[model samples]
Target: MPVLQRIVKPKTHKGKRAIVNREPKLIEDLKDTLCIKGSTASQYVNNAMRDLYDLKKPSAALLQKKNIILPFEDITPIENFSRKHNAPLFMFVSNNKKRPHNLIMGRTYEHTLLDMIEFGVENYVSLKEFKTDKISTGLKPMLVFNGELFDTNHEYGRIRNLFVDMFHREVVDNVRLQGLEHVLSFTAFENKIYLRSYKVSMKKSGTKTPRVELVEIGPRMDLVVRRTKLASDDLFKQATRKPKELKVKKKKNISTDNLGSTHGRIHLGVQNINSIQTRKMKGLKKTMAERKEERKRKLPQNNDTDNSKKAKNN
Candidate 1:
């Protein structure tokens, strides 16, 4: 699809005389069918058409009245008129004006340009010109120079590109998070900074469960650095040694009330000695009695069997 481009009008104060180059009938003819071909194109033709339709009755702001006050000096009558309207101002630091000095505009906020330079511009364009087909509305812009549409070579496309860059720069910067909290880690590379943060809370198992959150900060943007709340247990462990193992093992069976009546270590020691003696002598006496019974029974059986065999042989 052919991209529709827009020519953004300069913002102006109330009741200021301004001039723009446009034709209501011509713009109406090209409203729906043809595409506005330029680098700073927008897909919303509906919006562009609205701005174009409003241009049918141009604002009094673009009237280009004869007398008005401008902020800067060393300027001609044409410069004075352009300054009255919020026209894009292009100036050259050099005398020839061939090389681009700066493409300035009416102060977005006050009576100042973007670079803070307030010099009266050599050339100016009224918003009316961009809205109408009185001038070319394609790759080559219908330019207003000295209050007239000039078909000759001018810096319209370059100025448009510059304006697009200037406006969209903030949007690109805003892709990074506004601020970060509980950042677990961070990294930095060419023209970019990355941050890693954690979402964590105490778990029921007497352990900490951590969730990771990442952020990116700009390479050039200023940041207010702060310490994270999460403590590093590894660092604490490295600094402090483990406590020595306790020699005492508490007996589970002993009640807290009974613990006071008995001396803990002495009672444990006596019980342990008795347990050892009982284990050693437990099976010895039972084995001796069983052996004696077995010998008596076997002797009687042998005598009976020998007599039976002798009788059979005889």
Candidate 2:
């Protein structure tokens, strides 16, 4: 009768185990729940740990703070945000995990593994990835990025603090520098960061020195110079004034025939001067003849004339 009574106890309902807790108790293996699913507390802790390990990272485009800039367009080009800065951000589920994760989660993307883990562990994950879109969700485990190009250093502490403080306020206080490991530079202005196996050489042959030259063409300056030149030219023209010509009126000849005595005196004066000029001319001609005779006497005369006379006598 004791052996028959041991076989008589009925099995409890499986749904009764679910009713004990408001949240679903994740059972990894239905076949081996007796061994792995310890107490509810232990299972919760194990699930928490597993969620911590499953971190999600953001795409390089979003991680660069380029996403934060206002007036965002869905078109992803090689220029704009891609050329300037880019980085990868990893999201963990809790404060115990590495880096930091944004706590605010989107309702539309609540079905992903990242949302499930974040919701289960009570935090969201942030990460960086190469292939990222609006549908992207979850915690990424690893990331490759350039430290110098990113706004992660002490200089850009404001931006970094802004992001960290916006997400995990408590965990951000404890985030430590893990020493620079996977550093890269995306300063070449490319939308995507590609790994180069060989060294890329850049020459400064035609590239001019970068500078911001200030050119001045103000209206005041232009007016001043132009007015000065115009004023100077006007003054010069004024200084060299030309004299005006006077017009002489024609007068009719009123007879000098009316003054006989005055005409006679004028004719007499003219005749006296002419007579003096004639006398001087006569004296000049007589003096020239005398000088000609003196020159003839001084010249060596014809010894030929004497020779011809002698030759005729002989």
Candidate 3:
């Protein structure tokens, strides 16, 4: 069989396994995003994309002053860039008179545009405006969505899902309290959506649990719903279908709860516990034949006369 392209020989076993996991499989790997900016990108748009790029650094790529590609009209160029970088998610920022301070974000299915949403910036507050310290790089953020429309309206629901898919990095089983360093919040009201970022501050409390506070660290935006191009129902369904191997299988007799303890049931045949061999003192150790003979023999009656004499002398 012909070998695959761009496959490098890894020196270590760990490196080899890492490379193997990168291959296409039934369970898709985490998707990285590409943050792109055009020549017409303004100061506010530039700052927003820059901050987002830094925040998503561990799994995102940034391309600045690149091709003036707009997903609304022609997405081919954007798709090509994404394929080159191996990023399935992308955000394009531009500020022209026609669509001033516009942001287009989307995901790709097989390097083809799946869906795109365009938002016009009403107002923006960059991180530079806030004097708060920036969060640690590569720390996963907690995502929160506010407003009833996000849960009720179909389009709004899609938008909420897209933000989660794009901004959130790899999934994890558990997280530490200190590891939860930041939060990204989305609020929609009166036909406008507001995006906010905050730094989580842990304060001393008289009790065991510390008091928590949210300090706004910006790159905040007041966005107006401008345009949306969604995928067809059939295509979207196909894209979201999970393979059998990726589904969580129920363990045969195992269960767990909120606590760290594990619970399970084990079935076995009836056993003669007395016949089982166990540790013995050196003096008591004996061969199989001796053990059988000893078991057959009976012990003498108690020496009641000797015990009575010892008690009388005491």
In terms of lDDT, the best-performing candidate is 3
TM-score of each: 0.15, 0.13, 0.73
TM-score (C-alpha) between model 1 and the true structure: 0.15
Selected candidate, larger TM-score, 1 vs 2: 1
**CA lDDT of each candidate?**
0.29, 0.25, 0.84
Put down candidate 1 lDDT per residue, 53-160, tens digits, no spaces: 232223112221222322234334324433444332222211113312121122121112322121112222223333322321221111112211112222222223
Winner on lDDT between 2 and 3 is 3
**lDDT tens digits by residue: candidate 2, 64-134:** 11222111121122123222222112222222233122111111011111110121222212222222222
Query: What's the best-to-worst order under lDDT?
Result: 3, 1, 2
Candidate 2's C-alpha runs over 4 A off are 1-54, 57-144, 151-189, 194-314
Best-first order by TM-score: 3, 1, 2
Q: Give the higher-TM-score candidate: 1 or 3.
A: 3
- Candidate 1 lowest-lDDT run of ten: 218-227
Q: Which stretches of candidate 3 lie over 4 Å from their true place?
A: 1-22, 250-314
Clashing pairs in 1: 18-61, 18-62, 18-63, 18-64, 19-62, 20-129, 21-129, 184-196, 184-197
Q: How far is candidate 2 from the true structure (C-alpha RMSD, Å)?
A: 42.3
Query: Could you tell me the lDDT of residue 98 within candidate 2?
Result: 31
Shift of residue 156 alpha carbon in model 2, Å: 11
